[model samples]
Target: MTSSLMRKGSRPLRLPLLIAALAFSGAAAHAEDEPGSLPRSFPVATPAVAALPAAPTLGADIAGLLEQARASNPGFAAQRAETAAARERTDSAGALPDPNFQVELMDFTNQMRGGGTTLVPGRVGETRYRVIQALPGWGKRDLQTRSAAAKAEQAAAGLDAAWLDLALTIKQAWLRYYAADREAALARESLALLGGLEEATLARYRQGLVPQQAVLRAQREITTQRIAQVGIGQRRRGAAAALNGILARSPDAPLAAPAEPAALPSALDLPALIARARAANPAITADERGIDAARLERERTFADRYPDYSVGVTNNRARGENQTWDVMFEVMIPLQQSARRAREREATQMLAAADARREATASRLAGELGSAWSTFTSAQETRRLIRGTLLPQAQATRDASRAAFETGRVDFDAVLEAERQLVDTRTSLLQAEIEARTALFEIEKLVGETP
Candidate 1:
């Protein structure tokens, strides 16, 4: 009876598994018959992509925009102010400490006047005036001065780095604006082409040469293009707003269309770029200055182990006709050995940390330069291929299909498909152009331009 029950359970499990397998097979068969199934080869013939008119030449140039940002951006202005303050600090870093003055009344009450207090110094029993100047340990002042100067240099480098960041942002915004504007222009041109196709399809339908579906398809494509145009326009406005904000203007402020981006060089010298960045990149320079400052500070802390000195001169005046002069000297005792040692260790560790940071900064900058160079080269090649090969081929196919459709040799779908391919090819070219230019801007920000 147990064996009979186990066999019955196994039969039930097999029936479920068999049903699942059949269901999967039917789903796969249906997927293969689906109209949107991927084809092994792309369709080559399609309608013509209308050529866009030239953009108006009135626009803001990138150089002008960068200058405007540098002058107007509040963050950059704060950095400039900090740099100036650092410079001011350098002038007073090594100045001597303020002198001390004291006046002593040896006897404020006069015995001759029955113990009455005297207010005037000339009538007092004795009066003393002293002036004292304190001097730091040997070489401490020089070290402090050098350290402060190094810090000032670091601040200046930081200012330069901030400017570079602002410039890169402006360039990126300019490129985005250009790309969106071009896309919008392309969409408008495509819409006109679709309208012409719709009219032709309507005429063919009236003569019963084509079905109403063909005209409907044209109208749908026009609607789609119009939707895309609206999106592109929004992107364009957003880019403009970003630029305006960076320039310290109202976000809704209107901006002239962006000019065409500068062309990238045919070849880049990656090793040379890395070398330049190591020497000139402001962040790396700032780190190097920090190491110098830390070294000076460590030396100054070591000097703290020695004693400081104070010298004073005293003049004594009496009620009688006698005057005397006195000279005094004082020394600071460095009795806090534990505290001094701890401070020395702290300074030494800070020096090491600054050195490590400089090394890390250099390595990171090199890595970034290499990455940007790779992207720039890749985008350049892609742009070349699209413009030289893909664009012309797409245009030829579109023209051929459009001609065939007019002769009634090809269906309207072929023309529509070719137009899409042409538009896609154009978009790809624009993306490659923007990518290459953006990479070039990154490189410039990293390595700095030649003087």
Candidate 2:
């Protein structure tokens, strides 16, 4: 039975091997049929070394950067274009309708049969020409133009909002890059100090004053600091790249550090902040314009239920003959009640939706303002703590630990630990400062500060 089972398994394996052999033979034959053919892979560039010029950094101030971003950002530029188009549409809404021209040449006969005798026709062709134009009903053009103008104003406000958003993003990116630069510097400083400690430990060990273990520990710390410096440098580079990207630079562009801030306001009153935000916030203005647009649209659409009238003159001339003119009036009746009804309903729905959106936007803005205020407050508190208490205490501890270690009072490990603590405290202080600046930026952006 065992021999039979082995034979069955071996038979199946032979069939697979035969199939594999067939596939391999087919592949070999195909390769031989195609002479001097490279295997499929990524295509080589037609021109080697597509050297591109290094992109220039704007190195512009915050205001100038915001302006550049406004021009470069697709969203902001598109909104600006849309606003201009809407303005043109508003003008068109108030313009007169196109005129229509008509001409007709009536019968001109060379001869007329009168009592079986040929007679020339005395009166020739009667030619008529008319210019027809549709004159809008009273206030119709005004209403239509008003509606379009309101929409255009809304678009302008929308552009302002886009600008605000781009400015906020730029500010955040700049602050982050600045923080990365500072952190890199700190890491380098720490590495240098660790190197000095490492050398001192080796010298003491050589003098038979410290153990080999102490020297090895200091060496390890220096190595770790070097590694940290490398990582921090990479982070700084990444941050710089991001800042350049925000300014619409190519990947290879070099961006200068952001300008240092002179100072920040110590405190901002909540009432004043809210009032300024209300005055400058594009979202609120957009909502207001939207309301106006919806109201005008409703009125205009209702007015459409009535008929419009036109008046023009008709003229006729043939072969430089005397011209003839006829004055006439025309009126179109709105007989499609269903279409009118649908338009009114559509306008009503749009108006309601706009109002609802406005309410929602107001609610959302309030929440955002509250959060921003809280964050700014908390960051301020953190900065105060770091400056007045935490950093100074950490610095004192590190100094005392170093002195004690020098006097053979404390171990080298304790001194290293104090140094690490001091570094951590300083790092935290930098972080808090960055957070405070970022929070201020957010609050100002939400409040629509220009710079």
Candidate 3:
């Protein structure tokens, strides 16, 4: 009989990778065990579990990873560069059109018709020069500047959102890797424990207390578990590689299992979380910025409907006798009324679309926040029920059944059933824990905070 099942007692890691983003972010701790809540079971005399090194402080490790990723992640780097490039265009976008200077020379002077006097040229250098500067319609320049500034702000917000999103991605990958590692460790330990049980069963069979079928069952189960071990190993490797990719490391970069976060908060204030999400969510902020830009663009289009004025000085001269310096003015009329109106309509429509998109975005974020909160709450409860009740009861049942079988008081089938129940319950507990953590991470992403 396998005397005892190992209870997971690994210290939770404090993760501070999210600290720079929001003040509430901190390392979460796991829940305490209440002994009596465990099911009725006898303690089996089993060897102490193997010792594992204390996990590194989670906060420092997570923060360091984030820093490295921020500097090294190629996708994020590209987004940052794009934001900078957008900012660079602001000044150019708002600047006035360049003034023009022109000079012309005629190869030969021709007879000129004048109102009163006959014009004569002494030398062959017939020259004309003009310097022209355009003055845009009233408010056009200011509108252009506003539009450009808004665009820059949109890009800036987009970059901020991308940075937040990258943090979320890193968090998800880390959590997945951590969960996979834990699962693999549990699977290995379970296999070893199963070997002990198999030997105990074989000893009883040799003593003629149990049938050969019990030994065969144990062997068959071990074979099935070995297949599962292969799958678990593959999963662990895949998760590690995924995490490495996010950190901009080589695909085969080795990673130790990170410390798991403590249980999710039992009672999260959903309204408050939703408020935070509405206020701080990067996607929502970006959309709002986009709306501002779109509105400004509409204003710019309206400003474009008026005509522009060009004013400058012109000079025309003969070689020696006659020279004139005159002030010249020209007007650019808005002749293509239908085309201009169509553009204005397009801008107006785009502005409306942007506004609608913002509303839709807010609604979508709210929905996601609701969903994440629900999952977090549900997972939290599931883990509580499993850890505080199901796990203990199942362990107690397994211990009692194993002891009974050893004493020849219970059938071998009872022992097998109890063992399966315990294994299934333990596995369920692990999955529940991972769900809680994953849900919490999702909430953190939505609210832009983690604890």
Candidate 4:
């Protein structure tokens, strides 16, 4: 009778315990069905550490990048070094050849006769001292000096061009990094939103308020977003690697997310931009210097055909009574030498080549200016449109869909669609920003100054 009473008392507790165990089991099963469950052997990606330290936090501005390039970029440094070396050569032109000095003994008595030496003018054992100097061709040194100076100037301009190109490249890489970060963030947010929708839909289905099809659709979206996230993440990683490469770091080094580019200032008139480019652009200046150098070289080469004068003093002692000293000036007139003809021909060819190159460079820069100008204008318009209209519309649509879904008027599919639209719009805006930044870099590169 006591055992029967205990059994009746335990029935309520036993039923509740059984119900709780069943609920826990169902929750576990649902979690197992969820995507992104840690795999039995989920492979964690090891951090890439084979590369070097982070790039020095030189400001991300163009000027900072340019300065770094001048210091560390081998090509630019080589050009600057060349300029320095060329300028040093100009000192060679004005340098006079070493003056020669001579000393000799003169005898007034016949040494063969064993005569006594006399210390007097035109006497035996008299010592004579003299010096001599060589005169270079008239204006030859001046022309050579000018030519060397021009060459040095040309090299300096080339270095400037190198710096400008490097600055633009860094800016482009920075913009690319920003784009990658933006896209990756969007992908991550979409993935999280899809996962949340999957959980909500699963709950609704369990309550019998929504069909199993809704749960399946949410799962599909989660899978799709996960795939997109992976893809964007890979792209972001690649972009980071590229940024490291630009900073002269190993390509695998981890990089901090780059900042967005600053807003572009109001556009400059094309005419003004072109004028500034012509005056200050390194490529154009280099060509101009090259033309001047070529002219100087031509003049110097022509001067090479002229005669050079050498003045010297000579003393003769005959081992006898007779001795003499004479001062002489000699002119080495180079007759119609084959070398002169060759040099003239060479100079003519070089002058023609320089002229042609200058023209080509100018034409190329002009075309580039035009293209960059057009791109800047177009990107500005696109950026304005995105900021003013498209982004707002996408945001509004997404907000409306969220409200509808909360009120149970719209389905989970509508929410996913709205979310996808919002992500796309954001990505497009990022692209527009990148385009504008790239255009600005191009303008600065061509103009050699900020626009």
Candidate 5:
């Protein structure tokens, strides 16, 4: 063809090509939506699931499940029960010990030889009845009560820690589900875009405007996207199963995809966060209580090395004389000084161990909080970069490449590459957003609120 003829032929195609490329850009932009909503599937929605009472929203469902677990999860319920029992024991620790009752038959045996009129008696039989009570060494009972109360506090702290951990687990599982669902959707969108490009490329190849290799490349990308879709679907199912396990449901239970997590909390001062964790973190509280309990036990054990006494009032019935009452007292002395020393050493060692554990736990928790804070900040920064800079720039690149390809100034490969880059950036943004929120959940677990 002549030069002018070639230019004229290309001129007619430029408008149509530009229109198609613009449509491609529009589709890429539309592929991603508000993170809060992702389409989820029910592979085989069971009749039981369908028949349940009004289905709760995702957040509501999570909240309700957490509440249910307080009574349903065996581990949590057991810990709660232990806490209650310990609290009950604290009340009994300071109360007076139960009294002992005794009855004695004295001089009641019958004689074999009966020289007198009465054949059965050597003397008039007397019955004695008594009640006895033990008084703990001074300060021992009080120490016991204090120790019990402190241990009760420990149990309560342990339960609180378990509850916080449960919340963290739920948040992580929910985020995974959300991420998987988003990944699957993006894969499908990419597949559709590639399908459209494949059709367009085949048309141009047939017209001898583009080599057949372009058509094959588009087809290859479509197949790759399809494989990714399959993998993402599997991940979604696995994530959903894990979430259902937390909810105490069957493994195959269906769930509505969780909505976007709430935004990350405002940036926090790391030192302030560590201080909050020191004060409010349940594990630390539990350990501190353990130390108090151990110290009280050590003091009580030292007091126990003294002696406890028993006192009683006895009523005696005597046929030969008038009935009489007598008072009795007994004292128990600790003769095993070595054993007492051993007990003291055990309590001392236990107290030392508890102190060490508390320090280690606090230090570890502070370090963990710092790490989570860093990760959260990184994710937040990455998401902001993708949204404010990377995504828009990628769109512009796609648009520019499409303009070049339409005028035969660039290959179709450049436009495809730009589109893929945009999809990838969008995916990364979604993942970073989830990671940031998950880290925020971890901090909340430690600090009693978002740090």
Candidate 6:
């Protein structure tokens, strides 16, 4: 009984091998009967190089856009207005205070003469018309003028800073828009390639040269590319909206395609850039102006210790008496010593704070420049490597895999993976390009490059 059971199990195992052998033989016979029925290789699709948009002339388009933004952006306009207002304030800061005019009816009741009170100045015992001018302490006006001038300088520097910031933002936004636009174009190109592959795969499926799964995979890839294209389109629109917002345009406004960015200036060594920042960076300049203003304010505070005076001329008229002129002078006494001392201390602290702020701004800008320089160099190297080495390699691998798939030497998954790798490498190159340009723009902003 045990031998009988073992024989039954062995027969079941041998039956599968026999059937498999026959099926292989039948497939071989079928292939032999239909000569040249299967495709030996599929057409290799060559993708375009992942490059930025071409320009006939570098920097012209972007420069014009920046100028438009500067001219139309409301925020920048407000900043310019603020600077103008500050300049106007400097003119009035040192001007003399308005003079005081006084009309006095001395002894209006005339009690000493036993007369009734009178509201009329002419009927009073004595009427005086006085004009008085208060004078600030020595050197106070000059110090105030200098302080106001410094403040005006600070405002001008602030305007410069605003412009730098806006320019940087505009540059970055433009770059983002360019990258998205290019990526969308690439996606469309990829989709077209995939569509061809899908058609070829369906033909192979119909001929029974390849499995149905291959056709499904090709179709899936085409669909996925379409999905990615949708995403890229969304990103492109978002970037366009941001750029349009910067230019004070409607979100849905049409825009020209972006051109390639200009190369960095030949003189833009790191050390030279740092020097430029020191000399031209608006934040540092503003801080320096703040220090000057604070120093002048401190001096003016100390000058407050000196007394201010007022001079007056009076025209006196008395009833039944000749008109007379009187000259008067008054001096201000600085009696609040504690308050004045506190103010002096406050001014001193403010001056020190301003000095500290300048140092801090310089240090911070140096660190930012260093970071941007590092990023710029790294992105440039990455882009070069991808463009020169990785992109070509990926494309070659994809073509080889596709050929192998057609000849039945490799699986369909390998071909799909190769395509994905090629796409990813191209994307990485695009990102690297964007990063390098963005870092360059950051450096320009740090150095306060004007439009």
Top lDDT hit: 1
**Considering lDDT, where higher is better, how would the candidates rank from best to worst?**
1, 6, 5, 2, 3, 4
Instruction: Identify the leading candidate in terms of TM-score.
Output: 6
Candidate 6, poorest ten consecutive residues by summed lDDT: 53-62
Give per-residue CA lDDT, model 1, range 1-451, as digits (tens): 5564356536534657868999998787767654765453555454599999665332367877777787888999999999999999998999999999999887788775355797777777888999999999999899989999999999999999988888898889888888999898888888888888888888888999889899889999999999999899999999988888888988887677776665679979999999999988999889999999999999999999999999999999977868899999999999999999999999999999999999998899999999999999999999999999999999999999988988899999999999999999999998998899999999999996621
Query: How does model 3 fare in lDDT?
Result: 0.77
- Report the candidate with higher TM-score, 1 versus 4: 1
Model 6 clashing residue pairs (backbone) = none
Error of 4 at 128 (Å): 15
Instruction: Report the alpha-carbon TM-score of model 6 versus the true structure.
Output: 0.84
| Clashing residue pairs for model 3 | 14-59, 16-59, 29-262, 39-392, 39-393
Give TM-scores for every candidate, taking all chains together and pairing residue i with residue i: 0.82, 0.77, 0.80, 0.73, 0.79, 0.84
Off by over 4 Å in 3: 1-61, 107-125, 320-324
RMSD of 2: 20.5
Q: Write candidate 6's Cα lDDT for 1-451 as tens digits.
A: 5564356536434657869999998787777554655433445455697997654332235787788887899999999999999999898988899999999998899886678999798788999999999999899999999999999999999999999999998888888888888898789878877787778677778888889988888888888888888888898889888978887888887777777667644224788888899998999999999999999999999999999999999999987689899999999999999999999999999999999999999989999999999889888889889989999999999999988977878877888898889889999998988888899999989988887
What number of backbone clashes does candidate 2 have, counting pairs of residues 3 or more apart or in separate chains?
A: 1
Per-residue alpha-carbon lDDT of candidate 5 for residues 1-451, written as tens digits (9 for 90 to 100): 4563356536434557878999997666557433543433324343454555765454333564566555666666777888899899999988888999887756554232222333232243666779999998888889999999999999988888988887778777777888888788788888877787788788778888889888888888888888888889999889878877776778786576666555566576889989999998989999999999999999998898889989999988754667789899999989989989999999999999999999999999988999999998898889888999999999899778867866778898897998799899889888888888888888888786521
Q: If ranked by TM-score, best first, what sequence of candidates would result?
A: 6, 1, 3, 5, 2, 4
Candidate 1 lDDT for residue 23: 100
- What lDDT tens digits, residue by residue, belong to model 3 across residues 355-420? 888889878878987887788788878888988999899999989998998899998788878888
What TM-score does candidate 3 reach?
A: 0.80
Candidate 1 off by > 4 Å: 1-59, 107-113, 116-125, 318-323
